[model samples]
Target: MNIAEFKKNLLQDKISSAQEWFFIISVSLLCMIVFISSDVFLPFLPEMTKYFNTSMSLSQMSLTAFIVGLSLGQIPHGLLSDRFGRKSILNLMIPMFLLATLGCIFSKNIEFFIICRFFQAISASACIVIGRSLFSDVFEPLKAQRAFAVLVPLVSLSPALAPSIGGALSIYFSWRSSFVFVFIFGLIISLFVFIFLPETKPIEKRTKNLSLLSILNNFYIMLTDLKLLYYIFIVCFSTAVWWVYAAGAPLMFHKMDYSAAIIGLLYLPAVIPYFTTSLIARSLLKTKSVNYILNIGINGMMISCLLLFLLESFNALNVWTLMISVTLVTGSNGFLLSTAMSAGILHFSKNSGLVSGLLGTLQLLAGAFSAALIGLFANVFDKHYYVNLTILFIVCGSILSYVLKRKVIKHEAIKSF
Candidate 1:
């Protein structure tokens, strides 16, 4: 009935008639600041390459390195969230991110820029992964799924709008100024979260020593679980497809004669489906089975990829066709990411924070590896490379779906046993 009652119900895992949508919004806002800096950066890669006088592969190092930092921080941040708390992690990340962006703005050398990107990744990624873990901690299972459904769209808003923002800003100012906007966004979110966001983790559940052996033990348990592994594979696979687009799309745009601004605008539309479907996925959470939703989404991705291959086979090279395929993949992610995350922590409620950390680490680590590999086939100003890039990403997503499907069967078998 009141705030205290609502909090109690949420923690006790009851989905009553409470609207904690604002909590999801706050976390999404925090994540937007993080995603904006990283996701939007690639749209300007062509321009940045020219500015920094770096090769395409070399320029890519900055992105991959940032991702590596994101992967590396997942466990520690999750452990810290368990102990020091989510609000603390949120507050700590803000200043660190702001400083990292400022570093990007002022850095005169590629090495320095790459280092700053890495630092930024370490600070910024905490907001999303730990925040997701907190959501799992607070809400009932169905409610958590619905909450992420609302969030997927809002979170999708960042990737959709960020490039358009970056492209417009880069055209008017130097690429460095884009980092300044990231700085400002981080500063604003930090203030709001610090001032208003409530602490989710209790002192009792917190762990002080996040030693390697403990981490390994946690991971070992997770890997051995068939359900969690199945869901995580979807997260990894769907992300690979997204990265495929991320790697190839800009070059494709340049071939289409779109400037950075135009390329970003084109990129923006694909994320719309993601935003829309996230909201839909949340609503569907109460009604549909996780497997049902996942099957539909994975199929959509597979179909989207197959179509892309068809277009390639037909020599049908255009931005619109590419956009259609991208939209399907992004939209499907709306369902896939939410389901995977919800399922991931559900099986390990005792170690929700640690579970969040491991899942977060794998998701980012898998995405980074996929993206780095996908990047190999895509080059700046080379349209031909997109074919291979697309094929590779589609295959990755397909393999993920196939493996995850097998894991799903294993999960059911364990239950039957």
Candidate 2:
């Protein structure tokens, strides 16, 4: 090959086409449904207790079941997709999602409803793992980072909007209406994906052996790679911090005597920073290295956490301070999530399916654990728990940042030598 051909091959995603952009958007939209499934239930929690004739705690098991199913389903879906091909697996799962949505809508009892949500989350898991793997199949590291920078912010918006949509549906119609809304969404997405999205994983590249043991062994091997481990840690800590904030922020607002509606509006400011920082990240990737941007983001998060701690300790915590601190945390997340995912998946390109599955599984598991841990302490610590949780988040993030700097980043430099 000539020099030009070699350079072209070296830089993956050199050829940008309309079809590629459309495929990325379609996958992003598919992945967004996973968040929607979780968040839409948030507003329905109070009604759910009454609807199910159960205690609040028991009713909340629905969420936990969904989380478990979502986390556990990714590995199998990803493994199957790698063996069977992306299009067939995606087509199979989207319809299952639609069926699960319908089941949730009409269920007469809480147990059945929870079961349906579990299946719904399992089906949604396909979107996340396969969508990410598909990105790796088509784009190189830098281009994949750019694509995620755009995609992550859009997907993140589902949580911000879900409560509003859920609340409206519950007020105007019924709690059941929330599931109906999701069902209609599933129908539209299934049709769109079936008709338009092409199979990206071609026959030549499909894994010949489809065995559970092989998938698990590859998963374990990937976990042992130091660079991949750090990348996963970056995503885990970033997701944990967000879940901590999501769990504790409401209690802090309530202590300030803010009404539910007013408190809901506060999420808007926190969410705006995600979009702004994503735009900033996209622009910086044009000239800066991914490690540099990731370092800046992690440092920004640590500082934000420290500021939040001080503000709460001084009894100076208010909406503006809260907004600023939350913005820093969420904005940094926007950068970290996309960059970590791109860099991490690149490290395991040969096993993109396994890597994507492990990434999604650990990400959800970490977020769930974080949220649960914060919730356990919320009553005892009262409003101060938010400040303390932020500190914990920072402590965890700082360790990951050290690993990224000391190991992953330095290893790359040594490679150049």
Best candidate, lDDT-wise? 2
Model 1, runs deviating above 4 Å: 1-19, 39-65, 102-115, 171-176, 256-259, 309-317, 379-403
Candidate 2 lDDT over residue span 27-143, tens digit each:
788888888877786788888789789888878888888888898899888788888888799899998998998998888888998899899999999988888887777776677
lDDT of 1 by residue, 219-304 (tens): 78878877777877777776666666665667677777888667766767677787777677777777888888887787777777
For candidate 2, the per-residue lDDT at 75 reads 84
Q: Each prediction's Cα RMSD?
A: 4.0, 4.7
Report RMSD for candidate 1: 4.0
Which stretches of candidate 2 lie above 4 Å from their native place? 1-21, 409-417
Clashes of each: 0, 0
Query: Residue 399's C-alpha lDDT in candidate 1?
Result: 79
User: How does candidate 1 fare on TM-score?
Assistant: 0.82
